[model samples]
Target: MAHLLSVNAGRGRPADYTDAALTGIDKRPVAGPVAVAAPGGPTGTAGSGVAGDVIGDLRDHGGDDQAVYAYAREDLDLWQAELGRELSNGVFGENLTTSGLDVNGALIGERWRIGADLVLEVTSARIPCRTFAGWLAERGWVRRFTQVARPGAYLRVIEPGRIEAGDRVEVVLRPEHDVTVEVLFRALTTQAELLPRTLAAGEALNVLSAERIRRRLERMNGVPS
Candidate 1:
């Protein structure tokens, strides 16, 4: 059975490893329950996004589109074997580290019910950026991660409620689309040609993904974005 392994939250703080900006990437597992919900602000405050999860860079990082991020423990274990390092929960900056669930293979627009009432919809896959590369402190991390292309899924809060560690996770609803998060990662990172095919997922994609597909369409037809 799929279950929530941890509920992580962080605050904005200086990170020498990353660029000259405060980051909330060093998330730690919460001791008790934490609320999971959509943002109360237009862009979203630190606590408003998910009660305790902080968003340092709103312009590029946080918003309603990426309210929650989940990474599967199974996949983390695979990375652990490859990297020869013990990766703990929240080490990858994932909000909810899950077990047994196929986070990468999950279809976009899939609704997952956590705890009693917290519902999150799969929106997109987490993109590995400079911040992530720096936080990992690994050379060629972006390329290595992009090549591996198992980037976890980002979720949008659909129903607000409290959640905690060890909570059972259920797939409440799945859209009738075959486009999974892994497919999205491949299309966005490795294969530009697959971007146009993502239109099959329709509105399941977030604004950035939708725009990327549109630009791909334009480029294919020799039109300006």
Candidate 2:
């Protein structure tokens, strides 16, 4: 029953919420199929993996490691009840709004075959930023989100294909690692000591995230980074 509730895309819009002067966080659900591909290169060089989905902040948002973003409808519903507000698909800037999937609990390097041919690997968890906080216009949003620790997962496109709403999502592979999206998020944000534990994820960790952990661990160990 795990499937894509909706595939969303956003256009670039002027905004002071982020330092980029523009943001593509106001994503809206899109009908029909949407092309999915790996946006190769580093963060600043690559764009969104979903065609027609604009990523205005190349400095932080898009790349092979963060080619796609997925969030669970269940989590949205949880927030909806807490905040007492209606949250639509893609409201969190996720490319795929999924149903019946434990997106935040998925292990690093977990591969999902969406629809027929599109394969996406879980890379990391989204870190709330000023843009996201501004988008919600909620006070203490970043701290609140971090405390909840249900940050959605970012994905790396392993195979290019087209996907649409209502497509089935199959977990084709899951690496043997205890470092999941929630674990990784807490390691990177709130608990610095947990960074060493994330090394067990190995190559599943994204390039930038791995380097960050490595550097921090080195400093903690009194070794030169």
- Scored by CA lDDT, what does every candidate get? 0.83, 0.92
> Against the true structure, what is each candidate's TM-score?
0.94, 0.97
Q: How far is candidate 1 from the true structure (C-alpha RMSD, Å)?
A: 1.8
Residue range 101-193, candidate 1, lDDT tens digits: 999999989999999999998988888987888888878989998999889998888899899999999999988878899998898878877
77-152 per-residue lDDT for model 2 (tens digits): 9999999999999999999999999999999999999999999999999999889999999889999999999999
Candidate 1's clash total is 0
Best by lDDT: 2
Q: Residue 199 in candidate 2 has what lDDT? A: 92
Give me the runs in candidate 1 sitting further than 4 Å from their true place.
Answer: 17-20, 41-48
